[model samples]
Target: MNKKLLLICALISIAAAVGYYFSKGPERISVTQYKVAQGEVKASIANTRVGTVKACRRAYLAPAIGGNVAQLYVKEGDKVKSQQLLLKVWNDDLTAQLILHKAQIKANQATAKQFCEIAAGTERDSQRLSRLKKYDRIISEEQLDRAATKARADRAQCQAAQVAIEIARAKLEIVNTDIERTLVRAPFDGTVAEINAELGEYVTPSPPGIPTLPPIDLLDISCLYVSAPIDEVDAPQVKVGMSACVSLDAFAKKRCSGTVSRIAPYVLEKEKQARTVEVEVKLSDAKDLQELLPGYSADIEVLLASKEKALRVPTEAVLENNQVLLITADGVLEQRQFKPGLANWNFIEVLSGLKEGDALVLSVGREGVEPGAYVRVEE
Candidate 1:
């Protein structure tokens, strides 16, 4: 009886051990999977620093010769053409001076005409006197000499009067220029951004030792660009003519295409913490930019390289040594080496050893995620 009991206990212990062994089988790794796809793989660099939308040309306009603002032809937000008269300062005194100079020129011209007439008369008299002396020897030699002297004197007086007329004309031109200086004209085709002075208000120019407010602000928005700073380390990869995409905070939904127009030769030291280089990007489609204004905040993404229809996977799926863990047909992880092409922060291009429709492991550092380990895909 004791032997049978012992045998039953041994059988029960063996069955329990077998059941525990089967229940606690190999661990199954819970993993997320990615489906490889054929798409564009692009390597790009992005700047987090806020960029500025700048016009090709901007000006703070003020009168060259300052005085009370007499006329304002343009208001804020008015579009103007190059060389269009935009404003005028008080120039009554300058206008009066111009008129006075013109009258003086006219008077001088009249005097010149009178002097020329006198000269002609004196020359005729001199010729007549000389002819009489030669033919009849009646006129005295001294009288002929006096007539010739009078002719030369009158000619000199006429020349002097003509010179006076030229001087008066020059004075008139100077006054005309002064009057023109009192009028402010647009320097380029642009929109008026600001107007600081009202009619009858005094508008002064910027003095050498003092700062003054400008009467108007003009901005040429025909061509707009974004000035963004690139990290000095990434600056070497950036080149002029590279394609880029820009987004403005004001126009959040719209992204504008652009090309790299300029790259700074040297690094900028504006911030003490980081050294950066400025790059200017010109908008490819500037027509839509008309609605945008200068000084808007912008961001830029510069494309370094791109590949179309390439085999790509999420960047997190690629492990160190260019190895990727791909799920095999039996749902087991298999570590395979792949050749990498263009790679950015989010995705990487697989040059070889991968194809479309392949499944890849997406989880990072999960336990039981080694090679040959079975995985349960999370739906």
Candidate 2:
């Protein structure tokens, strides 16, 4: 009877040990989580590739008539005003021609004065002879006729001299125009970005269909814009006057506000690139544009829609089928499907099936994180 009791107790002890081992439950997987909250969510699009920060007005300046650079009034980084002289090509011959024309005009004016005086004297003599012949018979008809003919001829000579003056003035204008063609002036208020020609350097006009470097590069930094390429699908949604934000690679922490100013009417088809349409965004903030420079690599985000106070979550936390994982009060992973509204690269709006203060699993890719699995949330 003692042996039987000991065996029964041993059997019960073994069974209890097995039950305890099986009841311990699955191990908890460590995970990171984000609590649901109310914040701003925006729907937007960005450039498909890198974009360029460009000036609103940029001019590649060169003299219309090629010649040796005579004077350089501006150097790189010099600020200039509209119509200010930036450079002058060699125009000594033109200037000399201008001076000659002026001198010729003066000479013609003097000649005109002398001829007119002679004409006036001849007319007076003709009148006197006419009166003498008619009344006193002191002057003969031949003398009167000769005096009248001399008067008419002198008047004609005087008119010809006056015409010569006008011709000289016209010639002077032509020389002045030629001189202007040899000069390079700023088309608008800007800073000189580059100067390819130096004093005494001979610069030539670009040949037709072949572009060459201009002698001067002028950029209006006061007004700036970003030119970026957007995918063809997104281009149709973009319109002029839409709000935008510009981020440059050089200024990582700064973002400038802008508005869409233009969109290309056609798409660009490149062999290696996706079909894209060019878009321009004008920077609206004067203070933010002070540090921006042309040629800086940039990116642009055009806002399409937004929700100011939407329940949102980090975009990375959302999983397949618009679902997100959350830890229940009992510490088990729960997959919940939600309706999403506005979404961007950073955040997504939660429309339904999620509430504020619910901690969503951010580390959805972590091992052992799935529906019904126990998780240990990281603080």
lDDT of 1 by residue, 1-379 (tens): 9999999999999999999988988668899999999888899887759999999999999988779999999899999999999999999998999889988989999999999999999999999998888788778989999999999999999999999999998888998889888999999999999899999998888999887778999999888899999999999999999998888888756554788999999998887879999998888775557577789998888999998888899998888988989999878999988899998878899888888888999995798787999998999
Q: What lDDT score belongs to each candidate, Candidate 1 first?
A: 0.89, 0.91
Q: Candidate 2 on 1-379: residue-level lDDT in tens?
A: 9999999999999999989888986678999989999999999999998999998899999999889999999989999999999999999999999999999999999999999999999999999888777678667778888999999999999999999999999999999999999999999999999999989999977989999999999999888899999999889889899999988888766564789999998999874558999999988877778788889999999999998999999999999889999889999988899999999999999989999999989988887788999998887
For candidate 2, give the lDDT.
0.91
Cα deviation of 369 in candidate 2 (Å)?
Answer: 2.7
Off by over 4 Å in 2: 1-17, 129-149, 271-273
Give all TM-scores, in the order shown.
Answer: 0.85, 0.88
